[model samples]
Target chain A: EAGVTQFPSHSVIEKGQTVTLRCDPISGHDNLYWYRRVMGKEIKFLLHFVKESKQDESGMPNNRFLAERTGGTYSTLKVQPAELEDSGVYFCASSQVGAPDTQYFGPGTRLTVL
Target chain B: SQQGEEDPQALSIQEGENATMNCSYKTSINNLQWYRQNSGRGLVHLILIRSNEREKHSGRLRVTLDTSKKSSSLLITASRAADTASYFCAAPALSNTGKLIFGQGTTLQVKP
Candidate 1:
């Protein structure tokens, strides 16, 4: 089966500019997630989507970041007026619904905000 | 915030030697997973040990969990250059486990 896939493998933008990163989960997978890793830091959870509904978004950083899973098929994370600290790798993952399953990740999008 | 922490930030070993990495976490969890990532790539799930389990093995990978200590260890035996990667441990929060918080990761280098 094809694994999770992400677009624009790398993105470079300026501070105060906007950037959108996309993620396409494995087919038929209802659970999708977004995570990020800043320089010299651990990867962190951002949000979770089950089908067309958001399961949780507690990890989302601030008001400038918005993630949407339209039709629960694919996901997009948009950073408006990005900040310098927003420069990092954005990762997307998917898994079978419920617990006790493993999540597969895609090649992350490396975002550089100058 | 990241709940899991990997020890020894980095490690190096010969191809024939074994490499072990440890992870510790705070708070309760249902399961803990391990993942590997090359220098410029996404994470690949290595193994998962449930809260009730003590040990699991797949190929050359062995993972052990100790609830009392809230820690886990991953051992890769007879390593190869392909094993050179950053290893991370993840523990999903009890409420929304689909979102996994990861450790800082142990960077392992297996030299031939």
Candidate 2:
């Protein structure tokens, strides 16, 4: 019964570079979600992935951001040409679709765009 | 977009006192949840109250929802230094959507 886990706990990249953050959710969890909290801001939802398909991406900021959940197991969020504002703590969460509100979160990756 | 917004951005109280925080939202919700976050860390789920329910409790945590006013409140009874953390309220933006919008959060500092 492991909890959500995220990779690259901290990332420092150039403004024009690309970065990919990964999240391994709890085993048997069908709902995976991405969220972030920028400087002086609240945690905000980025997208939701139910299994291998994206359930909702309305929270996605712009085109430069892309998210995918492969094989309905793990998820990856990639940001190309990252901007200064993209620097924030990126969090990944997972839950059992049967109980959607009982989501468990990961440690989060601290992304710093230089 | 953010759904619930917490009041009193920060709070401080003695260890044995009770700390109450309020959250107000803009629309209807399927379920409202509370979470606690340590500094520079992930958030831990605290409690969840469904739209049809008015109040729920777990351990020392108490949660109440007022759908009529589109607001919710979280009360931590007999707080402790271990309770020092930021608290947030979240609600699903749309039913069956599997998405949640979180509040600004209330920072609680329980003094021993």
TM-score of each: 0.95, 0.93
Q: Who wins the lDDT comparison? A: 2
* Per-residue lDDT of A73 in model 1: 95
Output the worst ten-in-a-row residue range by lDDT, candidate 2 chain A.
Answer: A37-46
Fnat, model by model in order, equals 0.83, 0.86
Cα lDDT tens digits, model 1, B1-112, are: 5579999799999999999999999988889999999988998899999999999999999999999999999999999999999999999876755678789999999999
Off by over 4 Å in 2: none
Lowest-scoring 10 consecutive residues by lDDT in candidate 1 chain A? A95-104
- Evaluate all candidate structures by whole-model CA lDDT and list the values in order: 0.91, 0.92
Cα displacement (angstroms), candidate 2, residue B57, comes to 1.7
For model 1, the docking class works out as medium
How accurate locally is residue B98 in candidate 1, as Cα lDDT from 0 to 100?
69
